[model samples]
Target chain A: MVANHELQRAEEWSGLRGFTNLLYKENRAWWGTRRWWINALLWTGMLGGLAAMVVFMLPTIAQATDDPAVAKAGGPIPFGLEMGRTVFFELGAMALAIGVIILCQDLIVDEKQTGLTEWLLAKPVTRRAYVLAKLVASALAVMILLVALPSLACYLLLSARVGSFFPFLPFLGGVGIMIVHTLFYLTLTLMLGTLFNSRPPILGIALGVLLGGNLLAGFLKPLLSVTPLLLGKVASLTAGSQPLPPELLLYPVIASVLWSVIFIVVAVVRFEKTEF
Target chain B: MNQTHDHVIRTDGLSKSFGDVQVLKSVNLAVPAHSIFGFLGPNGAGKTTLMKILLGLVRPTGGSGTIFGRDVVRESVAIRERIGYLPQQPRFVEYMTARENLTFAANFFFSGPQPKIRERCEEMLELVGLRDKADRPIKNFSGGEKQRLGIALAQVNYPDLLILDEPASALDPLGRQEVLEVMERLRKHTTVFYSTHILDDVQRVSDRVAILNRGRLLTSGPIEQILNGRDGVVYTLIVKEAPQGFSERLAGLSWVTHVSAPETAGASVWQIGVSDEAAAETALLRFVLEDQNVTVTEFSRKKYELEEIFMELVKGESDGRQS
Candidate 1:
């Protein structure tokens, strides 16, 4: 019923046509409803609550007990920093890698199965725009809910235990490192979503890369340099202000970023040639 | 735009194949502007495949097509910008409200003030008679309501061409009537090209129709021309009592090609196939009344139903293929 003259022409053409609209729809799915607050509570409770227990409850337990072995194990506040660094860098990274795989598993496959992809492509939307919008919006949501906010909370919890602020820049760098690592898995899952028709293969291959990749890296030493294998160790060391050679830190970060880009390119290319 | 044919949609020798199976043969069709063009075909008749090719949802294996003089393959995006599509089974985001779905579909074309967009969505809801259920989630809608929503979304862009695949195929009688009524009202604004197997619906609403059977275009033209019978004109006469020379009286004329008298319970009926309509209209009835013993109960030109023609065409094509 919209009058013909009242309509405004959309300026977007080939590659970027309908990109903003799709991005808005994807963003609304994350932030416009209860999804935002629910994810914030879930990730914060898991990551920040564990950090709080590490810095506060451990020393209290060591003081309350008279056993020497328990006392030695509890150690001091530096021990809490090490534990907090492990919580944020290692555990947080692994949890977020798994979280992104579970979160974005349906981003493409569900739409394909439900006939939404055919419906969407019938419009003026280009295949590139569709895949790019999904990649950008989902990455932002996953990083914000699973990485940024929870990492900030962990930072404050560790700083509070030390009776002063922790080094802000180093912690921020570690958060960036964790984001790159998580994006590697996020893009992998999204690419797998495009390649396969169902959720199992996407979940299987992405999760395998996260868990099995680490296990295999223990034997295949060269994989530590070329893959995202050493990213967690480098993030933990960097956040704890421990120094190492620059290549040890730089190589994994570069490798993870490169792999994420490759995954996105594959997703877009495969989706372009897709029929319906 | 200047065109070889003033058609909103034109396809030349369009064909599609999946593996070893050829679903669409060389189909040449032209749909005129601002008309309700009915695409009639039975199941597995390649109706949906051809629609998908025009929409760029499926790639054709051979030939080409154009919409508004733009190439269907090279300029598909630009062509799509001026058209709206509704699949046979319209699917929407189940959790989103009807209003949200309309707005989503509209945003693919128009991007301006949010209030203007909202106003357009509301107008489409009102047009489809879904104003009362605008805020309801699509998951709660019935089959008819979902179809109405599909129509609303397909019209949100005010497209110049609207392609609907089996719009009323799954609906009840009332729902089908409502869909046809909506199509009737939109004829002045846009060209509607819809595919269906329902002969009655096509006969009632379509000005132009194309019948497809077994991936081949059997016949296509204005509905009236198609109903006039392709072989020639035929006249019918019912006689109560007929002399033995009654058949010879009609067949003796040069214009009359064949005369067939079949038995009826109360009277005798004759089907007169004529080479010229004027000759039959003037002399055929008079020839029957000339006999004093014969009582002419009924005399008129035979009218063909769409169902009859569709059956004949399908049967002929099927028989032709078998032999």
Candidate 2:
């Protein structure tokens, strides 16, 4: 027998029995290894690098060429901080959503395909704990690396030129909306992981939701309020402090949060019914 | 449903199917605690499927199973808390070291001082002789090495019931010997439920045995009882000089059911089947000595080999199905 004092008896039988340990393992896969730094470089380079190029390169090119059109192309808003907000919120929203889908696409499907899920479920772990751990860990990684870090670096870069800090509350609101929008795809991809055995369906359906929703939203205006399609518009409007009606913003925010919770609930329920 | 306190695992009418194809028929098994129960079967006999059901990796379609009297489906986490399973093809995170894999599995049941967990991991590493390679990544380990690590990981929790699916299938003879030795040491502490095709190992380590064929259990009992000759009592005798009428006389006896004498190297090897073992024991040797020309060299009850019995059982089941 194993020594009594060396290991606890594990008396807890809740659905979240092994949640903390599994979450620690998933977090270690991100934070304990070089995966965190690698992701840091990738997202920061993609989002922050794009912001840097736009902030410094556009005005320098405009000045060197003496082209009034190039200067005007920076948009009607005062150039530095406003342009940064527009780029970070508008393009960053779409890029980070795709990035989250690609990064977390394999989280469930790969473990299932490789028999790791079978191995884990044989332990004291419940199916809910397994899916929930993947969701929490991946969501935190996406939020930190994909949304918050890049936004912070972009804030500093855009603020360096303006000689005044951007409004903290609006920037925070934009970041919060970006997190919810990306998490919609994160939970959707994870839910797909429990529903399907392969990675393609998970990737295709999740990316299709982001890309397909954006494309078809023009034809179906209702998708804007029901899905995450109009999230970027709301985020950009919030970050730029442009005034808009509450209904235009409130619907998508509530819908995204509701959709994320629904996806998580479906993932846990479906995974419980799944056989090894 | 038997709910016996002595049995570590019990299944009644456990069945499973994949789509329209049935993989496991109704299997009722009782594995007594602290006994090495060898689950034997031909390929596709549903041994692994049954193990999976007990482990809660696969849900049963037809029946109910319990470990420590908890329902397998409803109380799987509770069942898993006291059991350690090594799957047929043991898999781990490829990037983690052997020690890390062990530590990770250990944490599933254990939460305490970090040093104690590390110490337990080290003990398992040494138990499987993987101490030298503890720090190497799993991807770099060979097949046999990985199997050894798999054993260590399975035992790190010191589970009350250790379920192994072909635990020694990937090992060399020497490694197989070491694994058997470890199982022997653990037999007094835990009930070992393992499945394998190697009948020699089963005969060596297992006290109880069950054989399955084509999704149905053919037979199960103690190893000695299963090897005690399922047919009837038979005794073998080597006669160096036996006249032609000598064999006829023994065959004509009332207690002797049948007799066969085959010539080999100028000697007659006789297999005498008897209905009354006491009658044969008291009279047969005296009767053989009555023939002055017959010199009896060897006389002993025939001991059946496990392979022979397994083949006879499986072949009989197959033939019964075909017929």
Candidate 3:
């Protein structure tokens, strides 16, 4: 009886043991290849180079014009805040969202189509572990290369032009918002990959939701309360004069986190039911 | 788990279907421990499907199976821990080298001292004859090399049961021989359950065999027992000399069910199928000796090739289905 109990215990816990190995494999795939490095360099260069160009040209354009609004826009505080806002909203958020989608689009679909999922699942790993490892590794890659690195570069370049007046909290908050926004699409793309075995449908559905959500949020003002479009508004809130409203800041963060969790749960459930 | 049971794998009334199409129909199998079991079937014969069910890759629609006394579906991870599988078309990450792939597979089972894992990988690479090309990516491997690497990866953990689906189906004759040799070596440590369309490979390596066709099990047992025919009563009698009514007289015997006489190089060889061994031993020789016109040259039971038995069983099943 004791042996039987021990066997049962061992059997129950065995599936959870190999998750780290799966994570390691995923990490090697992302970091060891040249693809991740190239993408990272391109994204950082583009975002940093664009911010520098704006910082150098804004003052020149304001001095040449007789417009008071243009001159005010070139002021140090406004220029720094506006530059930070542009980096987060235009470059960071959109590029990270698209980057997450591209990185994870084939995470589960290619494995299933090639029968690698079947091979790996035949080991001591659980379905949950397999899905979680992919999510964790891909999320880390997006965070380091697309979100964290580019944000740092953009902040430095902006500070050089606007004279170090950027507050740490608002800039950090902006970066957090971009991460949350990216997670929404990353998890959604993973869920879609689990649901479908082909590249076209996964890409089509994820890209459609992303571009369509942005388009629809423009027309539907109420969606700002819940959708990721609220994330785009973070730049303005951080750039404003007053302290950040708790509800205004809390709503989109909470909504993005909730949607990410839901997408992850749906992906795990769908992957569990998938037949090789 | 019962340690006394000799069977490593057992299934009762196992069936699987995808939508309206049934892929396996009430398959009952018992694979003995530490024996090489050959699963033989033609194309679209549900061989791979049955293998998948056992490994828990695919679920069965009806019935149950057990490996090492654990339910297949409920305790799949436990079952998987003790078994290694080589899929029909084995796929690995093409970007990773053979050594890296093996290391990745080994990591799932062994969390070890780094040196121990590296040593095991090197051993497996040498065993599969891929030691020189261990660092080369799998995309650079030939088909035979890839198949060999698949075998090494499957057996890396030294599993209790090694299930290989078509291990050498895509290999050349020399490559097939090498894969079979590896399997034969592994037989001492594990029960090898491999499915293949190659009968000669099965005959050369398998101690037990099972035949499946059209999603149904036709026959299964020891290789010798199956090759000896179900009834164990078949004899080949060779006679030389001139006798006009020799075959007619032999066919008239009550114990003979089938008699075919084909003249080979002026010698008539008659394959006599008998129903009773006692009758054949007591009266068969005397009956043939009674005919003074024909001189008996050779008299022995006919041995069957695996191909012959497989064809007979498959054709018999097809005929039964049509009728």
Better of 1 and 3 by lDDT: 1
Over 4 Å off, model 2: A11-13, A59-80, B1-3, B240-269, B272-294
Candidate 1, residue A12: the lDDT equals 78
Supply the TM-score for candidate 3.
0.90
lDDT of 3 at A240: 37
lDDT of 1: 0.87
Instruction: Name the regions of candidate 1 deviating beyond 4 angstroms.
Output: A60-75, B1-5, B240-258, B263-268, B274-294
User: What lDDT does model 3 reach?
Assistant: 0.83
CA RMSD of all predictions = 2.8, 3.1, 4.1
- Model 2's number of clashes is 0
> Taking the tens digit of each residue's C-alpha lDDT, what string does model 3 give over B1-323?
35426788898999999999999999999999999999999988999999998998889999999988889999998888889999988888777899999988877777665567778888888888999999987887888888889988998887899999999999998889889999988888899999999999999999999999988999999998888786577788888854887778888999898788877997888888888878998899889988788788898888899999999998899999999
lDDT of each: 0.87, 0.85, 0.83
> For all candidates listed, what's the TM-score of chain B alone?
0.91, 0.87, 0.87
Question: Sorted on lDDT, highest at the top, how do the candidates line up?
Answer: 1, 2, 3
On TM-score, the candidate that comes out on top is 1
**Model with the higher DockQ, candidate 1 or 2:** 1
Of the two candidates 1 and 3, the one with more favorable TM-score, higher being better, is 1
lDDT of candidate 3 at residue A187, scale 0 to 100: 93
